[model samples]
Target: MKRFLSGFLIGTAATVAAAASVVLTVKKQVIDPIDEQQVAHDEKRKRAMRKSAAR
Candidate 1:
């Protein structure tokens, strides 16, 4: 019984670690780029607005 409990705990910890790794990987590979693109787009829009206002 003790061995089984230990195994269960270890498995749960591993699963949690794996889930966290996946989330971080996705954020780094996918979400971060999208956010960077959004920031760039916002900057471009602001520049265009300033140019139009100056005109």
Candidate 2:
């Protein structure tokens, strides 16, 4: 019984650690500075083009 409990605890801890690492990686990708800036610049250019076309 003791051995089973120890194994279970270790497994649980490892799973939690892996999950935390995955979450951190995803968060970093979502908040990347270069991508965010590029997206903003692209949006501005599109808006400017639309306005020019309307003229």
Candidate 3:
């Protein structure tokens, strides 16, 4: 019973680690780019607004 419990815990930990790794990778590969683009877009919009307001 002890061995089985230990194995189960180890497996659970490994699964959680794998899931975390996948999430991080996805965030880096996919979400980060989108966030960067959004920031760039927002900056561009702000610049445009400022330019219009200046006129």
Candidate 4:
């Protein structure tokens, strides 16, 4: 019983740690400012090209 409990606790801890790491990574991607700026610049450039083509 003791061995089973120990293994269960270790597995639970590892699973929690992995989940936390994944959450942190997702949060960082969602909150990153540089990515937002790059996306906006790309969109603006695309719009400019489309306008020039229409002329």
lDDT of 2 by residue, 1-55 (tens): 9999999999999999999999889878776767899999999999999999999
- What global local distance difference test value does model 4 have? 0.93
How well does candidate 1 score on lDDT at residue 42? Answer: 100
Q: Cα lDDT of all candidates, in order?
A: 1.00, 0.94, 1.00, 0.93
Candidates 1 and 4: which is better by TM-score? 1
Rank order (by TM-score, best first): 1, 3, 2, 4
Candidate 3 lDDT over 1-55, as tens digits, reads 9999999999999999999999999999999999999999999999999999999
TM-score of each: 0.94, 0.57, 0.83, 0.55
Runs of candidate 2 with Cα error greater than 4 angstroms are 33-35, 38-55
Model 1 ranges off by over 4 Å: none
| Residue-level lDDT tens digits of model 1 in 1-55 | 9999999999999999999999999999999999999999999999999999999
Q: Give the better candidate number (2 or 4) by TM-score.
A: 2
Error of 4 at 40 (Å): 8.8
